[model samples]
Target: MKILTAVCVMALLVIASAAWADAPKRVKFTWSGGEAVAELNGSPSAESLWAMLPVTVDFKDFNGVERIAYTEKELSAEGAPESCTPDAGTLALYAPWGNLSVFYKPFRESRGLVPLGRFVEGADKVSTLGEAVRIERME
Candidate 1:
Protein backbone atom coordinates (compact mmCIF):
# COMPACT_ATOMS: atom_id res chain seq x y z
CA MET A 1 0.00 0.00 0.00
CA LYS A 2 2.76 2.42 0.93
CA ILE A 3 4.62 1.75 -2.33
CA LEU A 4 1.50 2.27 -4.38
CA THR A 5 0.72 5.55 -2.62
CA ALA A 6 4.23 6.88 -3.23
CA VAL A 7 4.08 5.95 -6.89
CA CYS A 8 0.76 7.69 -7.33
CA VAL A 9 2.02 10.85 -5.65
CA MET A 10 5.15 10.89 -7.80
CA ALA A 11 3.13 10.43 -10.98
CA LEU A 12 0.80 13.28 -10.07
CA LEU A 13 3.72 15.56 -9.35
CA VAL A 14 5.30 14.71 -12.70
CA ILE A 15 2.06 15.50 -14.52
CA ALA A 16 1.67 18.80 -12.75
CA SER A 17 5.23 19.83 -13.50
CA ALA A 18 4.81 18.88 -17.14
CA ALA A 19 1.73 21.05 -17.43
CA TRP A 20 3.53 23.99 -15.92
CA ALA A 21 6.44 23.53 -18.28
CA ASP A 22 4.13 23.52 -21.26
CA ALA A 23 2.55 26.86 -20.31
CA PRO A 24 3.12 29.65 -22.80
CA LYS A 25 5.74 32.31 -22.20
CA ARG A 26 4.62 35.92 -21.97
CA VAL A 27 6.48 38.81 -23.56
CA LYS A 28 9.85 40.44 -24.06
CA PHE A 29 10.57 44.16 -24.22
CA THR A 30 13.64 45.39 -26.03
CA TRP A 31 15.29 48.75 -26.44
CA SER A 32 18.62 50.24 -27.39
CA GLY A 33 20.16 49.55 -24.02
CA GLY A 34 18.98 45.98 -23.43
CA GLU A 35 16.09 43.53 -23.35
CA ALA A 36 13.94 42.15 -20.58
CA VAL A 37 11.51 39.25 -20.49
CA ALA A 38 8.40 39.26 -18.32
CA GLU A 39 6.43 36.23 -17.12
CA LEU A 40 2.87 37.46 -17.00
CA ASN A 41 0.37 36.44 -14.39
CA GLY A 42 -2.98 34.85 -15.17
CA SER A 43 -5.06 38.01 -15.20
CA PRO A 44 -7.48 39.56 -17.64
CA SER A 45 -5.33 42.64 -17.99
CA ALA A 46 -2.30 40.55 -18.76
CA GLU A 47 -4.19 38.57 -21.35
CA SER A 48 -5.36 41.79 -22.98
CA LEU A 49 -1.82 43.03 -23.25
CA TRP A 50 -0.67 39.72 -24.64
CA ALA A 51 -3.16 40.00 -27.46
CA MET A 52 -1.51 43.24 -28.62
CA LEU A 53 1.99 41.92 -28.86
CA PRO A 54 4.74 42.95 -31.29
CA VAL A 55 4.10 46.62 -30.62
CA THR A 56 6.45 49.53 -30.48
CA VAL A 57 5.97 52.52 -28.20
CA ASP A 58 7.79 55.38 -26.58
CA PHE A 59 8.66 55.17 -22.92
CA LYS A 60 9.27 58.03 -20.51
CA ASP A 61 10.61 58.19 -17.00
CA PHE A 62 8.07 58.71 -14.27
CA ASN A 63 8.54 59.74 -10.61
CA GLY A 64 12.21 58.75 -10.85
CA VAL A 65 11.24 55.14 -10.15
CA GLU A 66 9.66 53.72 -13.26
CA ARG A 67 9.01 53.98 -16.98
CA ILE A 68 5.57 54.74 -18.37
CA ALA A 69 4.25 54.14 -21.89
CA TYR A 70 1.00 54.84 -23.60
CA THR A 71 -0.48 51.59 -24.95
CA GLU A 72 -2.97 53.46 -27.18
CA LYS A 73 -5.59 50.90 -26.24
CA GLU A 74 -6.76 50.29 -22.69
CA LEU A 75 -6.37 46.82 -21.26
CA SER A 76 -9.06 44.98 -19.39
CA ALA A 77 -8.98 45.63 -15.65
CA GLU A 78 -11.80 43.32 -14.73
CA GLY A 79 -10.89 40.75 -12.04
CA ALA A 80 -7.73 42.64 -11.18
CA PRO A 81 -6.75 43.24 -7.62
CA GLU A 82 -7.85 46.44 -5.92
CA SER A 83 -4.28 47.52 -5.14
CA CYS A 84 -0.69 46.55 -5.75
CA THR A 85 2.70 47.45 -4.32
CA PRO A 86 5.33 47.59 -7.01
CA ASP A 87 9.00 46.75 -6.67
CA ALA A 88 11.96 46.89 -8.96
CA GLY A 89 11.29 45.13 -12.28
CA THR A 90 7.54 45.02 -11.65
CA LEU A 91 5.31 45.48 -14.68
CA ALA A 92 1.74 46.69 -14.39
CA LEU A 93 -1.09 48.61 -15.94
CA TYR A 94 -2.25 51.89 -14.46
CA ALA A 95 -5.96 51.46 -14.97
CA PRO A 96 -7.00 55.01 -14.31
CA TRP A 97 -4.81 56.43 -17.06
CA GLY A 98 -4.65 53.28 -19.17
CA ASN A 99 -0.87 53.32 -19.40
CA LEU A 100 1.74 50.60 -19.07
CA SER A 101 4.21 51.00 -16.21
CA VAL A 102 7.48 49.28 -15.44
CA PHE A 103 9.08 49.86 -12.05
CA TYR A 104 12.78 50.06 -11.40
CA LYS A 105 12.31 51.01 -7.77
CA PRO A 106 9.92 50.06 -5.01
CA PHE A 107 6.81 52.17 -4.45
CA ARG A 108 3.82 52.46 -2.16
CA GLU A 109 0.69 50.38 -2.66
CA SER A 110 -1.93 52.03 -4.80
CA ARG A 111 -5.37 51.27 -6.10
CA GLY A 112 -6.28 50.93 -9.79
CA LEU A 113 -2.91 49.45 -10.62
CA VAL A 114 -3.20 46.02 -12.21
CA PRO A 115 -0.40 43.55 -11.79
CA LEU A 116 1.02 42.23 -15.04
CA GLY A 117 4.40 40.55 -14.59
CA ARG A 118 8.01 41.02 -13.62
CA PHE A 119 11.21 41.13 -15.59
CA VAL A 120 12.96 37.81 -15.51
CA GLU A 121 16.17 39.16 -17.03
CA GLY A 122 17.98 42.47 -17.58
CA ALA A 123 15.91 44.22 -14.95
CA ASP A 124 18.77 46.53 -14.15
CA LYS A 125 18.64 47.85 -17.70
CA VAL A 126 14.98 48.82 -17.47
CA SER A 127 15.88 52.26 -16.17
CA THR A 128 18.11 52.85 -19.16
CA LEU A 129 15.87 51.83 -22.05
CA GLY A 130 15.78 54.23 -24.96
CA GLU A 131 12.67 56.25 -25.81
CA ALA A 132 11.58 53.70 -28.36
CA VAL A 133 10.81 50.18 -27.13
CA ARG A 134 9.61 47.08 -28.93
CA ILE A 135 7.50 44.49 -27.20
CA GLU A 136 6.79 41.04 -28.60
CA ARG A 137 5.40 37.74 -27.45
CA MET A 138 8.02 35.21 -26.37
CA GLU A 139 7.30 32.17 -28.52
Candidate 2:
Protein backbone atom coordinates (compact mmCIF):
# COMPACT_ATOMS: atom_id res chain seq x y z
CA MET A 1 0.00 0.00 0.00
CA LYS A 2 2.81 2.40 0.91
CA ILE A 3 4.57 1.70 -2.39
CA LEU A 4 1.42 2.49 -4.35
CA THR A 5 1.00 5.79 -2.49
CA ALA A 6 4.59 6.76 -3.26
CA VAL A 7 4.09 6.05 -6.91
CA CYS A 8 0.95 8.16 -7.01
CA VAL A 9 2.78 11.09 -5.41
CA MET A 10 5.61 10.80 -7.92
CA ALA A 11 3.12 10.82 -10.77
CA LEU A 12 1.46 13.94 -9.41
CA LEU A 13 4.79 15.68 -9.13
CA VAL A 14 5.64 14.85 -12.69
CA ILE A 15 2.32 16.20 -13.91
CA ALA A 16 2.78 19.43 -12.00
CA SER A 17 6.26 19.91 -13.40
CA ALA A 18 5.03 19.41 -16.92
CA ALA A 19 2.27 21.93 -16.46
CA TRP A 20 4.69 24.52 -15.16
CA ALA A 21 7.04 23.95 -18.05
CA ASP A 22 4.23 24.51 -20.54
CA ALA A 23 3.04 27.76 -18.96
CA PRO A 24 3.13 30.99 -20.93
CA LYS A 25 6.40 32.82 -20.64
CA ARG A 26 7.23 36.45 -20.03
CA VAL A 27 8.56 38.91 -22.58
CA LYS A 28 12.07 39.31 -23.93
CA PHE A 29 14.15 41.81 -25.87
CA THR A 30 16.74 40.84 -28.40
CA TRP A 31 19.27 42.91 -30.23
CA SER A 32 21.97 42.17 -32.70
CA GLY A 33 24.40 40.99 -30.05
CA GLY A 34 22.48 40.53 -26.85
CA GLU A 35 19.14 39.75 -25.19
CA ALA A 36 17.26 40.55 -22.00
CA VAL A 37 14.23 39.13 -20.20
CA ALA A 38 11.49 41.36 -18.81
CA GLU A 39 8.46 41.06 -16.52
CA LEU A 40 5.37 43.27 -16.59
CA ASN A 41 3.76 44.84 -13.51
CA GLY A 42 0.08 44.42 -14.46
CA SER A 43 -0.62 48.02 -15.49
CA PRO A 44 -2.92 48.81 -18.41
CA SER A 45 -0.14 50.67 -20.15
CA ALA A 46 2.10 47.71 -19.70
CA GLU A 47 -0.64 45.46 -21.05
CA SER A 48 -0.95 47.70 -24.08
CA LEU A 49 2.75 47.43 -24.66
CA TRP A 50 2.60 43.66 -24.31
CA ALA A 51 -0.25 43.48 -26.81
CA MET A 52 2.02 45.03 -29.41
CA LEU A 53 4.88 42.59 -29.15
CA PRO A 54 7.36 41.49 -31.82
CA VAL A 55 8.25 45.14 -32.41
CA THR A 56 11.60 46.34 -33.59
CA VAL A 57 13.05 49.81 -33.00
CA ASP A 58 16.34 51.62 -32.98
CA PHE A 59 17.46 52.70 -29.55
CA LYS A 60 19.52 55.82 -28.94
CA ASP A 61 21.05 57.47 -25.93
CA PHE A 62 18.73 60.12 -24.57
CA ASN A 63 19.19 62.99 -22.05
CA GLY A 64 22.62 61.60 -21.20
CA VAL A 65 21.03 59.14 -18.77
CA GLU A 66 18.62 56.85 -20.58
CA ARG A 67 18.11 54.92 -23.80
CA ILE A 68 15.00 55.97 -25.71
CA ALA A 69 13.23 54.40 -28.65
CA TYR A 70 10.33 55.60 -30.71
CA THR A 71 7.77 52.79 -31.06
CA GLU A 72 5.32 54.97 -33.08
CA LYS A 73 2.65 52.76 -31.50
CA GLU A 74 0.72 54.60 -28.86
CA LEU A 75 0.10 52.82 -25.54
CA SER A 76 -2.75 53.51 -23.15
CA ALA A 77 -1.84 55.63 -20.13
CA GLU A 78 -5.08 54.98 -18.30
CA GLY A 79 -4.76 53.77 -14.66
CA ALA A 80 -1.18 55.01 -14.55
CA PRO A 81 -0.73 58.28 -12.71
CA GLU A 82 2.26 60.55 -12.64
CA SER A 83 4.25 59.17 -9.75
CA CYS A 84 7.75 59.37 -8.35
CA THR A 85 10.72 59.29 -10.63
CA PRO A 86 11.84 55.89 -11.80
CA ASP A 87 15.18 54.46 -10.80
CA ALA A 88 17.93 53.16 -12.99
CA GLY A 89 17.10 50.05 -15.03
CA THR A 90 13.42 51.00 -15.12
CA LEU A 91 11.42 50.81 -18.33
CA ALA A 92 8.85 53.55 -18.75
CA LEU A 93 6.65 55.04 -21.41
CA TYR A 94 7.03 58.72 -22.10
CA ALA A 95 3.47 59.52 -23.05
CA PRO A 96 4.25 63.05 -24.10
CA TRP A 97 6.47 61.84 -26.93
CA GLY A 98 4.82 58.45 -27.29
CA ASN A 99 8.21 56.84 -26.99
CA LEU A 100 9.74 54.13 -24.81
CA SER A 101 12.43 54.97 -22.28
CA VAL A 102 14.88 52.52 -20.74
CA PHE A 103 16.52 54.38 -17.91
CA TYR A 104 20.12 53.64 -17.14
CA LYS A 105 20.50 56.45 -14.66
CA PRO A 106 18.15 58.01 -12.12
CA PHE A 107 16.03 61.02 -13.07
CA ARG A 108 13.32 63.20 -11.56
CA GLU A 109 9.64 62.53 -12.06
CA SER A 110 7.78 63.98 -15.03
CA ARG A 111 4.18 64.08 -16.15
CA GLY A 112 2.86 61.66 -18.78
CA LEU A 113 5.34 59.00 -17.82
CA VAL A 114 3.98 55.50 -17.22
CA PRO A 115 5.65 52.53 -15.64
CA LEU A 116 6.15 49.51 -17.85
CA GLY A 117 8.26 46.37 -17.46
CA ARG A 118 11.90 46.21 -16.47
CA PHE A 119 14.70 44.11 -17.79
CA VAL A 120 15.41 41.20 -15.52
CA GLU A 121 18.63 40.34 -17.29
CA GLY A 122 21.18 42.60 -19.01
CA ALA A 123 19.84 45.60 -17.14
CA ASP A 124 23.27 46.82 -16.23
CA LYS A 125 24.13 46.90 -19.91
CA VAL A 126 21.09 48.83 -21.02
CA SER A 127 23.12 51.90 -21.92
CA THR A 128 25.33 49.81 -24.16
CA LEU A 129 22.62 48.25 -26.30
CA GLY A 130 23.30 49.08 -29.92
CA GLU A 131 20.80 50.05 -32.58
CA ALA A 132 18.00 47.79 -33.81
CA VAL A 133 16.22 46.03 -30.96
CA ARG A 134 13.39 43.52 -31.23
CA ILE A 135 10.78 43.04 -28.50
CA GLU A 136 8.56 39.98 -28.34
CA ARG A 137 6.88 37.47 -26.07
CA MET A 138 9.05 34.55 -24.99
CA GLU A 139 6.49 31.92 -25.96
Candidate 3:
Protein backbone atom coordinates (compact mmCIF):
# COMPACT_ATOMS: atom_id res chain seq x y z
CA MET A 1 0.00 0.00 0.00
CA LYS A 2 2.76 2.43 0.88
CA ILE A 3 4.56 1.66 -2.35
CA LEU A 4 1.40 2.21 -4.30
CA THR A 5 0.86 5.57 -2.60
CA ALA A 6 4.43 6.63 -3.27
CA VAL A 7 4.12 5.63 -6.90
CA CYS A 8 0.94 7.61 -7.26
CA VAL A 9 2.48 10.69 -5.71
CA MET A 10 5.56 10.48 -7.87
CA ALA A 11 3.42 9.94 -10.93
CA LEU A 12 1.37 12.99 -10.09
CA LEU A 13 4.47 15.11 -9.68
CA VAL A 14 5.88 13.83 -12.94
CA ILE A 15 2.67 14.61 -14.76
CA ALA A 16 2.33 18.06 -13.24
CA SER A 17 5.96 18.98 -13.69
CA ALA A 18 6.08 17.90 -17.30
CA ALA A 19 3.12 20.06 -18.23
CA TRP A 20 4.86 23.22 -17.03
CA ALA A 21 8.16 22.47 -18.72
CA ASP A 22 6.47 23.02 -22.05
CA ALA A 23 5.02 26.38 -21.10
CA PRO A 24 6.38 29.67 -22.38
CA LYS A 25 8.92 31.16 -20.07
CA ARG A 26 8.32 34.44 -18.23
CA VAL A 27 11.06 36.60 -19.66
CA LYS A 28 12.39 39.30 -17.28
CA PHE A 29 14.89 41.97 -18.31
CA THR A 30 16.19 44.51 -15.78
CA TRP A 31 18.49 47.42 -16.34
CA SER A 32 20.50 49.50 -13.84
CA GLY A 33 18.06 52.13 -12.55
CA GLY A 34 14.58 52.91 -11.26
CA GLU A 35 13.23 55.06 -8.44
CA ALA A 36 9.98 53.39 -7.46
CA VAL A 37 8.34 50.07 -6.49
CA ALA A 38 5.21 48.81 -8.24
CA GLU A 39 2.70 46.00 -7.91
CA LEU A 40 -0.34 44.19 -9.38
CA ASN A 41 -2.08 43.14 -6.18
CA GLY A 42 -5.70 44.03 -5.73
CA SER A 43 -6.05 41.69 -2.77
CA PRO A 44 -4.07 41.45 0.46
CA SER A 45 -2.67 37.96 0.35
CA ALA A 46 1.05 37.61 -0.21
CA GLU A 47 0.29 34.83 -2.68
CA SER A 48 -1.14 37.28 -5.20
CA LEU A 49 1.84 38.96 -6.77
CA TRP A 50 4.75 39.04 -9.24
CA ALA A 51 7.74 41.22 -8.49
CA MET A 52 9.97 43.03 -10.93
CA LEU A 53 9.84 41.07 -14.16
CA PRO A 54 12.17 43.14 -16.32
CA VAL A 55 12.42 44.45 -19.90
CA THR A 56 14.88 46.42 -22.04
CA VAL A 57 13.37 48.81 -24.61
CA ASP A 58 15.02 52.16 -23.95
CA PHE A 59 11.99 54.07 -22.73
CA LYS A 60 14.00 57.24 -22.13
CA ASP A 61 14.91 57.55 -25.80
CA PHE A 62 11.26 57.84 -26.77
CA ASN A 63 10.90 60.82 -24.44
CA GLY A 64 8.11 58.74 -22.85
CA VAL A 65 5.61 58.72 -25.73
CA GLU A 66 4.72 55.44 -27.42
CA ARG A 67 2.04 52.75 -27.79
CA ILE A 68 2.24 48.98 -27.50
CA ALA A 69 0.48 45.62 -27.98
CA TYR A 70 0.63 44.23 -24.46
CA THR A 71 -0.20 40.70 -23.37
CA GLU A 72 -0.29 38.36 -20.39
CA LYS A 73 0.59 34.68 -20.56
CA GLU A 74 -1.59 32.98 -17.97
CA LEU A 75 0.08 30.20 -16.05
CA SER A 76 -1.15 27.38 -13.84
CA ALA A 77 -0.20 25.04 -10.98
CA GLU A 78 1.68 23.00 -13.51
CA GLY A 79 3.79 26.11 -14.00
CA ALA A 80 4.22 26.55 -10.26
CA PRO A 81 6.34 29.67 -9.83
CA GLU A 82 9.67 29.54 -8.08
CA SER A 83 7.77 30.92 -5.10
CA CYS A 84 5.31 27.98 -5.34
CA THR A 85 2.58 30.55 -5.88
CA PRO A 86 0.55 30.94 -9.06
CA ASP A 87 1.42 33.90 -11.30
CA ALA A 88 1.41 35.17 -14.87
CA GLY A 89 4.00 36.74 -17.17
CA THR A 90 3.60 39.95 -19.20
CA LEU A 91 4.80 40.69 -22.71
CA ALA A 92 4.94 44.22 -24.06
CA LEU A 93 4.80 44.87 -27.78
CA TYR A 94 6.89 47.96 -28.19
CA ALA A 95 9.86 49.47 -29.97
CA PRO A 96 11.61 52.75 -29.14
CA TRP A 97 9.13 54.95 -30.99
CA GLY A 98 6.14 52.63 -30.87
CA ASN A 99 6.47 50.77 -27.58
CA LEU A 100 6.14 52.80 -24.46
CA SER A 101 7.83 51.34 -21.35
CA VAL A 102 7.92 48.09 -19.37
CA PHE A 103 7.16 47.44 -15.71
CA TYR A 104 6.58 44.28 -13.65
CA LYS A 105 5.55 44.73 -10.05
CA PRO A 106 3.94 43.02 -7.08
CA PHE A 107 0.15 42.99 -6.78
CA ARG A 108 -0.42 45.94 -4.46
CA GLU A 109 -3.18 47.81 -2.56
CA SER A 110 -4.92 49.46 -5.53
CA ARG A 111 -4.54 47.21 -8.57
CA GLY A 112 -7.47 46.98 -10.93
CA LEU A 113 -8.77 44.49 -13.56
CA VAL A 114 -6.36 46.11 -16.00
CA PRO A 115 -6.69 44.43 -19.41
CA LEU A 116 -4.59 41.55 -20.67
CA GLY A 117 -4.57 41.34 -24.50
CA ARG A 118 -6.77 44.22 -25.63
CA PHE A 119 -6.05 45.85 -22.27
CA VAL A 120 -3.05 46.89 -20.26
CA GLU A 121 -1.23 44.68 -17.75
CA GLY A 122 0.19 47.99 -16.50
CA ALA A 123 3.82 46.89 -16.41
CA ASP A 124 5.51 50.20 -15.84
CA LYS A 125 9.25 50.13 -16.53
CA VAL A 126 9.54 52.56 -13.68
CA SER A 127 9.11 50.22 -10.74
CA THR A 128 11.90 48.30 -9.12
CA LEU A 129 9.81 46.51 -6.51
CA GLY A 130 11.95 43.46 -6.10
CA GLU A 131 15.55 42.44 -6.20
CA ALA A 132 16.74 41.68 -9.69
CA VAL A 133 17.14 38.09 -10.73
CA ARG A 134 19.78 37.78 -13.42
CA ILE A 135 18.33 36.76 -16.79
CA GLU A 136 18.86 37.20 -20.51
CA ARG A 137 15.85 38.31 -22.63
CA MET A 138 16.48 36.94 -26.12
CA GLU A 139 15.07 39.23 -28.79
Q: Please name the candidate that would achieve the greatest lDDT relative to the true structure.
A: 1
In model 2, what are the clashing residue pairs, if there are any? none
Per-residue alpha-carbon lDDT of model 3 for 15-76, expressed as tens digits?
98998654333333344653322232222221111322343233332222322222132212
135: Cα error in model 3, Å: 4.6
Off by over 4 Å in 2: 1-25
| Shift of residue 94 alpha carbon in model 1, Å | 0.4
Candidate 3 residue-pair clash tally? 13
Give the lowest summed-lDDT range of ten residues in model 2. 20-29
Clash numbers, per candidate: 0, 0, 13
For candidate 2, what is the TM-score? 0.78
Candidate 3 displacement at residue 77 in angstroms: 30
**Root-mean-square deviation (CA) per prediction:** 5.0, 4.2, 12.5
Whole-model lDDT per candidate: 0.89, 0.82, 0.31
Residue 104, candidate 2: how far off, in angstroms?
0.8
